[model samples]
Target chain A: MMQETVITNANKAYALLKADADKILKLIQVQMDNLTMPQCPLYEEVLDTHMFGLSREIDFAVRMDLIEVEEGKALLDNLEKQLNLIHEKSQQR
Target chain B: MMQETVITNANKAYALLKADADKILKLIQVQMDNLTMPQCPLYEEVLDTHMFGLSREIDFAVRMDLIEVEEGKALLDNLEKQLNLIHEKSQQR
Candidate 1:
């Protein structure tokens, strides 16, 4: 598998800029998953805006190589959409 | 404020390497805060081991300068003990 067809063409070029990278990737998946927590200077203002929106979608999917940079592979490819919105909000409870 | 006294000397130089940076900062605060979530390649194997253990405690607190790399100020200086372990596990319920 040639690197999963270049990450399925970088997830179809991140579906044409994944709706502004899913707005800070859904606030970094609701602060990971406690569902909320952003108070002190807004918790460093949302972890410095989700570390600059997931490092600008892993630097534009590694300048179009899609991924493969010393194993990190472009930040696990945007951490698979913050773990699919934390399992679609825990299967809507 | 001279950058909060150099992040309180990088939280006292991360309390002398804050006990191995509080062991991967408490597994990146229990995968943020659901308390636990690690499966499927162990979830990119713990987000690549908490992104190489919080980028090696922000590169040894930015090579001992303690912190301050532009407004990020060295990753909100390790997101303040992952927000005090999610408020001490919500004040122990």
Candidate 2:
């Protein structure tokens, strides 16, 4: 019964995180959409703020061992790749 | 020479990514540390902003096949776990 309860609670939390992530992504999209050709301070500020929050959450997870360090490292690697691509693309234009 | 160039470039990008992530984490910590009693809207805002950015970057990486979706999924699962724990602790306190 306890195991079942844990599963249900975890599942519920999972749903909430997914929903929260979706909403934030949507918010980003809205910002990106309204982006001027240069996509001003506000756009970058918003993006940086969001990205920073995610990293902190990941950092906390690692510190707490809720997620393996390797996984967090991998996520950082992936984020770095995307960040570089975005930076390069923006610079190229 | 070509392989060396790719390696060097990727390495440089990795360093930048690490630094960027660290700075962002510091910024979040600053916000967190400044929390007065309840840690109001701004604190949550900063945290959520960063988390969402991380998720979106993960999503884009998955779409580009730069990172495996399973890896991204795992990261999300871990984030959800940490969030729940944080929420619970906050509630109990």
Candidate 3:
């Protein structure tokens, strides 16, 4: 029963993470579509700091055993694959 | 010159991401050492939210051509592997 509860909470947390990631990606896509280079360095700086913070959170989760390592990787990999596709599309522009 | 500048910025950002990730993992290790289960659900909730934000930032960067998809994956994979090692050690306990 205890194990099941933890798993359920962890699963819900993962879903929230996934949903937020999708929202963020869409925001980026919108920004890209509306803007033209050269992008302001400030934007990159803000984004870098953001990614840094996220990576740390994932690390924390893994260490705490709050989420399995494989599941964490899947969350990150999904973002990477989606971003790669976006990058490829932009390149062809 | 322009291409070189962008590459340099991206490289620097990647370095920051790597460094921050390492710091986060270390922090988690420290927390685990001092604490015992069951962990606070609030803690997991906070970490999940943090990770979600960071993934978004990474996606934004990729969409902006600020970083390559491969590099982003590498950053995430490093965290995953390290966490896996930590998980394995904990399991053997």
- Model 2: residues >4 Å from true position, as ranges? A1-93, B1-39
Which candidate should be chosen as best, given lDDT against the real structure? Answer: 3
Model 1 residue B76 lDDT score: 44
Clashes per candidate (backbone, < 3 Å): 0, 6, 0
* Candidate number with the higher lDDT (1 or 3): 3
Instruction: Sort all candidates by TM-score, best to worst.
Output: 3, 2, 1
The CAPRI category of model 3 is incorrect
| lDDT per residue (tens digit) for residues A8-79 in model 2 | 533443343334345546565554445533357666776667556555545544442234567666665665
Model 1 C-alpha lDDT per residue in residues B6-87, reported as the tens digit of each score: 4665565545444544665665566646744333465444445444445544443443354444423434445555655565
Overall lDDT per candidate, in order of appearance: 0.50, 0.52, 0.59
Best by DockQ: 2
Cα error, candidate 1, residue A91 (Å)? 33
CA error at residue A21 for candidate 3, angstroms:
12
* TM-score of the A chain in model 1: 0.31
